[model samples]
Target: MNVSQPGLSRSIALLEREVGAKVLERGRQGAQLNAMGTALIFHAEALEAILERAREDTLLRSLGLEGSVKLGVTPITAAGIVPRALEILVKAAPKIHVSVTEGLDSEIAEMLRRGHVDLVVSRIGGGSGYQELAEEELFRSDWGLITRPDHPIARRASVRLSDLRDVRWVLPAGGSAFRQQMERVFASSNLGWPTQSINTNSILAIKAIVMSTDCVSLMARELVGVEVAARRLCIIALKGVENQRPVGVMWRRNETLSPVAARVLEILRRISKDELAVRKRVELPKKGGRSVV
Candidate 1:
């Protein structure tokens, strides 16, 4: 009671006001419990303990630290970016359990609508349904041409849309936002568009097709950066066409995030900020290289 006397007195006074009884005494040391006060304090202490325990339980459950979060992402996200980000999330919150599903953007969006994933990491497409979702941009990157290191475009300092004009292409399907953006860019060019284009759903398949055939593909620069750096694929700059697109996180607007989901989102946003900072630090100025405008 000594430790919690002030709180207890406040509680008793509030109770006494409703009950019309004197429940506490003011003294030199502090509040003193009368007979009625003593009895009420015992019950109040017990109730407080129960409520505290209940609150702790609810907090833990809500955070999903003791439960699991279902998340969906596009293939490019699953392959590298998300996995790297999750590694950081695990380090920060080990108790959190996450189940990840990888699919093309359309499929993943459907999954999110059906209550499959608690959150989604995807491109901000022109879809009207996603307009109301709470979203934050994670990264922005320009589209670049990806091909085998020995591909003809690889030798060029900067590849023009005309350079890829006649090449057969392996591309993500029209349903994919990235694919649509690529198509739009090409359609605006003097090259028109690739009639010989093959629509693929798999990023791996696109890379494979580009490697095995005289085909070229476009992808976000960061998505293919590791492969480009390793010399497995070449990322040729798209001179004069700076198509910087934003990758973002989205969650249902009507739904409140569970504790676990919130924690995961926090981790993702933090990682995004860190990645953006690093990108900004190393990024070339607008006059020198591509800008994600």
Candidate 2:
């Protein structure tokens, strides 16, 4: 990818010779993909996916184990459901390998479509227009107005959406679903946006800023689970069910999961159910592999 222009042109020329057709239409401007190139590229990507899957299976057969999975996740999912689910997976099936890619939903959608990832764990918000993909609900968590315990908003007996109009916020950047959720809350209540938006998508950064400063955040309750349980953060009990949504497993429709991936999926379902129960109750579950979240 970092090669010089002449070197790249030589490589493309070689490919064109092997294909017995001019894949690139070369001009003074630069080489551009021809119609033949465009068609070839689609099947090339599909072939790459098949090769990757075959390799994972071959490695599994050599090692006498289940296999590997390419797992895609949104940032929120990495912080929330993934950790607890993987913890159980490794203990239950230590021989299986997992590779995780963390990105925004849009980026992850493309990855899933191209077969760069075998499955996706993310929140479902209308979703990208990939009818080939299907989602299975794993857990549901509500969006909350969160702040430090001693913050002015937290001390209030009751809060309103208008109260947040003047509040400073540590929010995700405009493109994120989390940010859209926050905007929806304000718009539905006929309130203006926050006076100061301290933009970031990191749950860790949001929690750190909220605890050290007077800023508030609109976040999924499950994302701040450990901190909330430790009294380091608190939800204001606004928008109980209004913005609640399912966190699910998204994979290609009609494609059977690889053996190791199916095993990991089973563990994810088990851990997510337990994780949900804890958030709804005052205390956590006493069971092992189910209480980490």
Candidate 3:
């Protein structure tokens, strides 16, 4: 903060030369970070956080457990699993501080590779392209189509993929895992993709759009279980389209997890087991009733 203008300029020039890119724009309005500079600052902050955590670990060793964990999670797990697990983590290890980043699988994987996050909770299959990471399945959830409770399709006894082709839909953008799964479902059903669709990566936006409009979207049951139970949304009864995906905790392979991270992981595993058991109970058929399974 006490840096002189000339010294700051020299530092910026040195960094630019090292990176071989102009990180800042100099003008009458003063120096401003360009896009590349902003990205560099973000990574630099992550590195600083890592160093701070290291310092905390070194100093807190004799005073019992006290450290920080940077965790990344996908939207569904962020909404469903992280809260419960974090609750347990806080109660068990009061001195441990946790930072959470919510993102898609690919985004979180990149963060893990860059050492930005200590661990990630994301989908485990379909060639995630993170060969340097290790993952353990936390739970499995089935994907299903969701719409407003009073939507016309929600009233039907059964819905088909073909029926969805003509409806407005909210879908994830291209190359995302959810989008790929939706494409596979369309291909398997021999139905054309929906022409009227809004593509986005925000789970909250998708849910809001689907619940307020005639649009429908696919999501993990666990993600929307609370909403469905509250009668805010309804799952379209579709046969032969059940797709189960495994969600899990992932960390860099060959690296030992920090004490706080390890403890948080343990809490997540226990919570996931309980969640799976609850899901199984909800999935079980009632007496003299047919089960979706």
Count of backbone collisions in candidate 3: 0
The segments of candidate 3 whose C-alpha lies over 4 angstroms from its true place after superposition are 1-52, 56-65, 242-244, 281-293
Candidate 1 similarity to native, TM-score: 0.68
Task: For residue 28, give model 3's deviation from the true position in Å.
Answer: 35
- Name model 1 segments beyond 4 Å from true: 1-65, 130-132, 242-244, 283-293
- Candidate 1 on 120-165: residue-level lDDT in tens? 9877644646544667788776777887877766666567887666
What is the per-residue lDDT of model 3 for residues 1-293, given as tens digits with 9 covering 90 to 100? 99998998899889999999999998999888899999898679757867876776677665675787889987778878888889888887787767899877889888887788899988887587767889999987776778887787776655678666678889888877777777888778887777889998777889989989999988787778778777787765567775657888999897789878898888888988887788768864322121222
lDDT of each: 0.72, 0.77, 0.80
- By the lDDT metric, which is better: model 1 or model 3? 3
lDDT of 2 by residue, 1-293 (tens): 68998998898889989999999887999878999999789768967997978987797769887678889998678887888888878887887778999887778877887788888998875657788888888877666678887776775543567656777888777787777767777777887777687987676898899988999887776778788777787776564237555788888887788777787778788887786786678554322212222
Each prediction's TM-score against the native?
Answer: 0.68, 0.78, 0.74
C-alpha positional error of residue 25 in candidate 3 after TM-score superposition, expressed in Å:
29
Q: Any residue pairs clashing in model 3, and if so which?
A: none
Which of the numbered candidates is closest to the native, going by highest TM-score?
2
